[model samples]
Target: MTLLACVALISAAISFSSIAEPLTSAQQNQVRELIRDTLVNNPQILEEAVNAWEQRSTEQAGARLGKIIEQNKDALFNNAASPRIGAKNAKLTLVSFTDYNCPYCKQFDPRLEQIVKKYPDVAIVLKLLPFRGETSQSSAQYALTLWQQQPDRFLALHQRLMSKKGNHTKGSIVSALKSTGNDNLSIDKKTLDEVRSSLRLADLLGVQGTPATLIGDQMIPGAVSYDVLEQVVKAQLARTSS
Candidate 1:
């Protein structure tokens, strides 16, 4: 038997013994000696065992995440308070948790636009997570306010904000607001609550950083390439259609 298989059998035996009669001191020593000799002879078993454990852990994590997504589907996808783009009733939907001041989110902005243009049946729900600091918080509040008061102008403001690089200043934010004819916008209680809600959702999803994209059962972190984004979208579409 392979060393890994032997290790599994040893673990099973120990569990069985615990439920019945515990292993005697001599039997425990024998098991330990067997493992020691196996490892000494075939050191690669350690690497194989580690890889197997990691794969199982990853699969378990993915399954847990999928369950969470399923439970919160309405909040993630159909929230009227969230800013959204692309088809209204899409066959495939993507949820993105982003910070306006996050450079990676800025970098990923155009790629999202490209996806919208290319796939008419796809929709993107934008959750404004402003965990970067004050600048991020301000932008998120403003964006949410615009989405609440003037939905038509929200996309223009959103694209303009995402197009900007680095930290946003008061002046830069005001300029973008004015350009979108929303310079008079002010953060209201509702907007603040919405931003807070997004933050909580991000935390629940285990999103540690900005530019986290959710497609189907997977939550992909970082600014993935357009090709990768498209591939995931297509795969999701296929699954849904199947």
Candidate 2:
């Protein structure tokens, strides 16, 4: 592989580390030995290997999600909440797991929109992956209720809430929804009660924070610029298309 390819693979390693939980020291040591053996004579891959390891961040080693993004690509794209408008069977799918109250998620929301608009063939799925405290849970419930009960209205509410001027408080969200001619809608105690009752999807994804995204085989945590995201998405799209 070329140097760029090596970097890309190393990036993948970094991405993997962020999504799933970190490996045990023994396991990491074993992987190091394996690379040493494989690259016993190849200095380039050896360097690549070291860089991949050295560059890995703790965020990359999510306990339940680290290894999931790549291993479960097919299911993620075709799963519930996957987009119906974008490329359904396209070579690329970007799944975002975010919190309504997460400031980073707010920052990422627009960048995500631009990415999808730029690559219409890439299907984007937004899953409610809340990992904060009770407030986050309630926000997620409110959002998901909108998605399930008033999908069209829910997306609008979501975008607005994810904006700088948008409000995250319950009263604020309701008012925003009402202004959108959804006055008849209700996210009152009953609705909130219902949303809080069920949240199996979040558990399955093993999300620990807001603004976590699954781009192809990579799970990116925190806010990222379009430039960095574009490189990763484009590389995966190329790999899939190839």
User: What would the per-residue lDDT of candidate 1 be over residues 62-137, giving only the tens digit for each residue?
Assistant: 9999888888888899889999999988998899999889999999878987998899999999999887888888
Query: In model 1, which regions exceed 4 Å deviation?
Result: 8-30
Poorest stretch of ten by lDDT in candidate 1? 1-10
Model 2 stretches with alpha carbons more than 4 Å out: 1-75, 81-85, 132-135, 164-167, 187-206
- Residue 139, model 1: lDDT of 87
| Overall lDDT per candidate, in order of appearance | 0.88, 0.64
Q: What's the true lDDT of residue 133 in model 1?
A: 84
lDDT of 2 by residue, 1-242 (tens): 54565456656766887799887788678667755654565568767766877667544665346465445555565554432235656668777777676778888888888877788678677765545555566666666656666666666766766763433666766665576666566444544433332234344565566677777546677788989989988998888878
